[model samples]
Target: MAKNTVQFQQGFSLQEFISQYGSEGQCHQALFQWRWPDGFKCPKCGHVRYCSLKSRKLLQCNRRRSQISVTAGTIFDSTKLPLTTWFLAIYLVTQSKVSVSALSMKRTLGVSYNTALLMKHKIQQVIKERDDSKPIASYIIQLDGAYWGGKKRDGRRGRGTTGKLPFVAAVSTDDQGHPIEMRFSQVRAFSKDAIIEWATQHLCIGDEVVSDGLNCFNGLDEAGFDHRVIITGGGPESVKMAEFKWVNTIIGNVKRSLHGTFHAISKKHFSRYLAGFCYRFNRRFDLRQLLPRFSFVDLRTPPIPQRILKVAELCG
Candidate 1:
């Protein structure tokens, strides 16, 4: 009801995206404006005045005569692809419930699989970095540790399965129980020290953290968070309890969406995929703003080379 209000509803349409970012010039204009809201300035000399080269689309600092391309220092660095192509990639990434895989990107964007994979990784890294720069703080955060991946032939089961990844899912709600913010993060494990480290990074002082009774979560309080552990004892009925209704629902949705969409994702790449899910969910209420906001974030992110992306950690 309240979420259906104009302020919280999604208003951005495909037509709107096309009109705003249809051409290379249009996307470049938006990037130029976002990259330098006050006008072009040399990163080297910090000069406000500059001259633009129409032939090469480069800018020169008036004071030091330093030259800078529109994407020199930003995420688009060294990119030979057109701005429209990048903008379309950003749009597809942001405007989906599940993620746009490399295969999907190749089909949709008309690129090779390798090129699509590179583009997807680059954009995913941008979203991950952007979310990492901000902290989530709310009155109430419903948290739970979850595992992903199929069973192993080693006969290990459940959370202890050999190939699974341990991720912490948290959804913050208002006093009335309406969901507000969410943070889904992949952790090294669900140990006490891990939870403590997570709390220190993602939460603020006095924020209440709600969780099913797990001993590992006990460390959150020691890290200065106001922790509340609700012991449901392990049972199917208890799992259906209203105390963690939204948290449970979100976890189910995340699992289903990921499993249903991708054929199979590598273990190390789980963090990036999870980051994409969180990025879309966290911005769900800001439907119309997702594309432009994500574009701006991409502009702020440093260009992530393939080798660097391969070694980057999503959680750390």
Candidate 2:
């Protein structure tokens, strides 16, 4: 990594984003490059040769009579919104420290509330799917938890009971001892199995895991994890590990970003939102280009009936 923070800072402005990718066709081309870096291939026939329908922006397959659009088989498939709006939404969400709300995004992008909500959810899902494929394999992993969403009124913490949920996060340290890799999962119960499952999925075994004195981590020895518990009650000497500081800094950043930006987060969809937060936080350095480079691939297709049922279930 070349440590280019300029892109992240410059692209944070909405005016700059509109100036760069204002046209739907330009946004489509950028997505096309992201989907097929080498070239386009027919999803149906697996043939690379295709005629470009310049008028409709579609590719006519040479082997088959069918025509395919660049947005086919992606999240944008069948979407009525302009590609430029989607690009701007992705850029804005990824660049912001706190994830933007659908309401705010609707106002910002001049789209309907429902459209903004769907766009936010779809982009967040894409980021989650992409990041989930690349798990954090190595490095000093620091684990901690934080409770979000508390109201403050008249100089009090407001009973600290705003129905906020608890989230467990892990951050990896770089060679220079700075935090780099990050992962977060919403937790209902802080049990041993829950912690171990999350750790095994996102991290490799034998990686040095540091946490505070929590009984849930006591079983890591049996789970084949190199785990250590730091008793903060033992004064500064016990908390001497720099890795712990890095983890604390990550947690603090998440809290500040969430509190300052979104204001409040619902508990029902907390995990998905947490995943989006972690995605943005991890890529905070190169979000400008990376954010625009994301495309919705058909990695996993939800059955329409099942998706509808799940939505109904959640609504109920």
Candidate 3:
């Protein structure tokens, strides 16, 4: 009957965001501090002394004379949009409980649909890169597999169904079974080999992994995890099982959130979209810090151009 503190907590307000990063100058200053907290240092030579090239908005190294723009090499590189637009985009993406579609972003940011989509993907790339680097290491972990995409008219359904994308969803819980950290990985298939590979990279050795009795999950034990199998056979009842409660709930939320927000998700970019949800979920404890934290990571993330974003396949 008690209120959930996390749900009720004060988040970063639009007024506050505007006060902090209302102008291009404010965004540039914040980016500068995030990129170089100590002071200006040449990226090429690591020299401490630098002079500003106000004429072109670049910083020149005193020793090497090499010039670099504050946005160079970051996710903002070569962007024709103002830093204010980028900052507002970050605010909308990070602060939204569910995800924001590019169409909505286009209307809000007043940019072309393609440009909005590019910005969304580029920001999601930063989030995906940041979250993908932090693997889950916990004592009690709930694991489950879920599929994305619409249902087909064909008789095919469930695992191995045509047009469905298989992904592994996991949530690390506390002793009382409160979900903490989470992970969502898009795998080629939910086969034994695929499960093993994903477990090796995202899960830690000796962690307790509780999952449904899917044969492919047998790979968890082989991969050095203390695997606990719960055979809650199909239908709605399986999702109600206590042992897999958190994982199932998270998977449900992800499916509903993504399906409700975006009209379509490309096969090549599914991982990044999944990563965006995981990133926000893992950091949900502090809504107030989400924007600044995301901004920091965005500044450090390498540039992802339209060409790279258009790649046919992902490394996943």
Candidate 4:
């Protein structure tokens, strides 16, 4: 079988994307390929051969009794919306730098707000699941914290802030000054325990870790990590690791995207939004493949609409 090939350019419009893989069948076929690269098999009977029921888009197990739809046992399971809408939502989320509002999604896809929110949450769950599986290690990682809040009041920054939350981020840097992996979280405090736990969970022991002077990260040496601290007081002269600058840039971009696009973010679901942002940030350079792969999930379902709209309203 020939490999599925997709080409995308920078500033590519959504209409072009829809034209490429616009149908539910096309999206389903890609999901089938991603789910089972080898071929279709019956999950129940462990049989390699199964008959495809084109009418229901299901694979019937010839050896045994139950019928399974293409979405069984995956994130797409139990969804009532069309697979094409999900695929489109995924594509939009991956392509956009900031979180896309469910209201916009509803208008774009012609679906109810509830359905859009549900689909967004489901996609976020899938992304979180995938991130949990792939741990970031064996690279130079930069650690930092940034605060996100609602719109600025009276042209003041970092003050008069309400509904703000703290986020800790770890970004793995490549030799070419590009980020290879990114992990983020919403936490109550940047305490020693919190920082250590976040580091241990996302990074391996041997990798080098760099951070700006934060007392919470003082004893990283005891944890088997080559930790370096850069003092922020002395401007660029106090900088020890240049990589932190890139990491800071990443954080700045994230904050700017959130503030400009969403306006305000709630603490309750900050991690989900962070995960979505991290996923997009790490894959920003690979929009061609990522966008197409993203376009393969179902987003018109009800759950996603609620989650997305609620988050958007909270942010606004």
Candidate 5:
């Protein structure tokens, strides 16, 4: 008999993670591979030859003699933390079914709360950037909009709460009804224009989009997708409909995970947090691949200070 496998199920264990990436040398070697798969070419002069300056722990391009640290120009650039700590953080965030909180990370990594918080945000941002370039193509996408953190003292629900941030969720499932990919983003609001832009950016022609008959979703009219609007008329019965199975389940699980993990997340950085969930869920089939996947992205992604992450989100 075949047992059901949940999204978080994977073979990578804690002992395996520690054994594979326990030391600074191990992590450094991994980063070196991710950074230069073919061979080391100087970013400045493109020279293949390089020599390590042991005192400064730098790789100097033989031709230009430019010094490049292993962390140079990467997400870990200008960090005093060891590569092992960063690698452990990546493992913690990617492996957990429920997200890990900054405070919990502080305790786990033995770092200060502020440092843990910064590291968490940095990794989430990398996840966001990695998923940003992926769009739904040739698949039936379940579309829904959700509000987070809008619990009010008056016990009001759904739309127009001071604390709520609006986000749209989309999931692509296989013929057998298993989720394969997910796209989520925090938006200013659920309006026609907003949905139009989202559809254009994240959706493609062969993709069929299914959304609850929210009038705003009509924006997809010219989005070049075969779109269907199913209005369940707002009730448990409607939500139970098979048409919405994957999307509804995903939203429920994500909300629950967020609630269980963090004490509270502000609206500005909500998109990054959502990305963390989306990244994990979208790649759920092979959770063991997450560490290497994230390491590659971190190696490729541009560096940004903690200040820039907040400012960029706020400005957007």
Candidate 6:
């Protein structure tokens, strides 16, 4: 009967984004502030005083005379794009609920597909790195194993499907059983060793983990966490069970978002996409602050080289 606060909330709009980071100079100033919150400290010498050379957009450290731009060493390093454009890209990526694809980003930003893909991957790399550093430690955790990719026609099915990727979906909830954060991690397989390794890295000890009756989940017990299994047997009835309600709902939402946003996803680069989704979902509580917070993290994240960015690696 009551209004849903998160659904009805006022989110950050393009108008507000323009008002704040509308110009190149505005974006530069914002990046400077976000990068050096305690005032300008030289990255090389740690000098507190610096002279801003507005003509060339560099700062000279008073101590060592070392020069640096606010964008230097950060994800925006050596980028030819205007800071305003970069900020807009960040805004679009953070503000969307279903996530943005590189092709859609190309159309929106009026850039080539390759350039847009580069920008998207760079931003997602920063997000993936940031989220990977923080592990889920919520009191009540719900976890489920899932697979991505369409069915193969070779008669192979379910977990053994040739083209499918195995992944674990975990939702951390509050005392009232509402999801507060989530982690989507790709795994080698649903074997005991794999589950133990993933759980050891992603989940904290002493937290209770709720899951269905999958034998692989016994690894959670071996990992020394409090594990509770609800045997919701397969089919529609199982998915409808209350014990797995939020986890099932989240998984469904994830599938929908993937189907609606992306046409196809490569297996190697899939982890970053999952990490990007988790990053957005975990930070969904404050839509207004999402841009600034994401930008702040972006400024702190080191620039990932194009060579490194092109390679696929595992990330949660």
Q: Which candidate should be chosen as best, given lDDT against the real structure?
A: 3
Worst 10 residues of 4 by lDDT: 295-304
What are the per-residue Cα lDDT tens digits for candidate 1 across 17-62? 8999999789878888888788776789877998877788788888
Sort all candidates by lDDT, best to worst.
3, 6, 5, 1, 2, 4
**In candidate 2, what are the lDDT values of residues 36-86, reduced to their tens digit?**
678977778889888889898788999985798877667767778888877
Across residues 1-316, which tens digit of lDDT does each residue of candidate 3 receive? 9989888889889999999999988998888898899998888998999888877878899998999899988878887899999999988888888888888998999998777888888888899888777678576999988788755567544554666789999999988888888899899888899999999888888789999898899999888889999888788888888888888888889888986887677888888889888888888889988987987887777777667686333221
lDDT of 6 by residue, 1-316 (tens): 9998887789988999999999989998988888888888887877799898889899999888888988887778888888887888888888888788888888888887777777888888888888878788597899999888756577633444655899999999888888889999999988899999999888899989999888999999988989999987777888877767887898889888888888778777788788888888888878998877887888777678778666233221
Report the candidate with higher TM-score, 2 versus 6.
6
- Model 2, which residues run further than 4 Å from truth? 1-16, 54-56, 150-164, 234-241, 296-316
In TM-score terms, candidate 2 sits at 0.81
Candidate rank order under TM-score = 6, 3, 5, 1, 2, 4
Which portions of model 4 miss their true places by more than 4 Å? Answer: 1-16, 150-163, 234-243, 291-316
What is candidate 2's local distance difference test score? 0.69
Runs in model 5 deviating more than 4 A are 5-10, 151-156, 159-163, 310-316
Work out the TM-score per prediction.
Answer: 0.90, 0.81, 0.93, 0.81, 0.92, 0.94
Q: Number of clashing residue pairs in every model?
A: 0, 0, 0, 19, 0, 0
Candidate 5 lDDT (Cα, 0 to 1) = 0.81
Query: Which should have the higher lDDT, number 1 or number 4?
Result: 1
Candidate 3 minimal-lDDT segment of 10 residues: 307-316
As for TM-score, the candidate ahead, 1 or 6, is: 6
What lDDT score is found at residue 245 in candidate 2? 83
In candidate 3, stretches whose alpha carbon ends up further than 4 angstroms from where it belongs are 152-157, 311-316
Give candidate 1 regions above 4 Å deviation.
Answer: 1-10, 152-157, 311-316
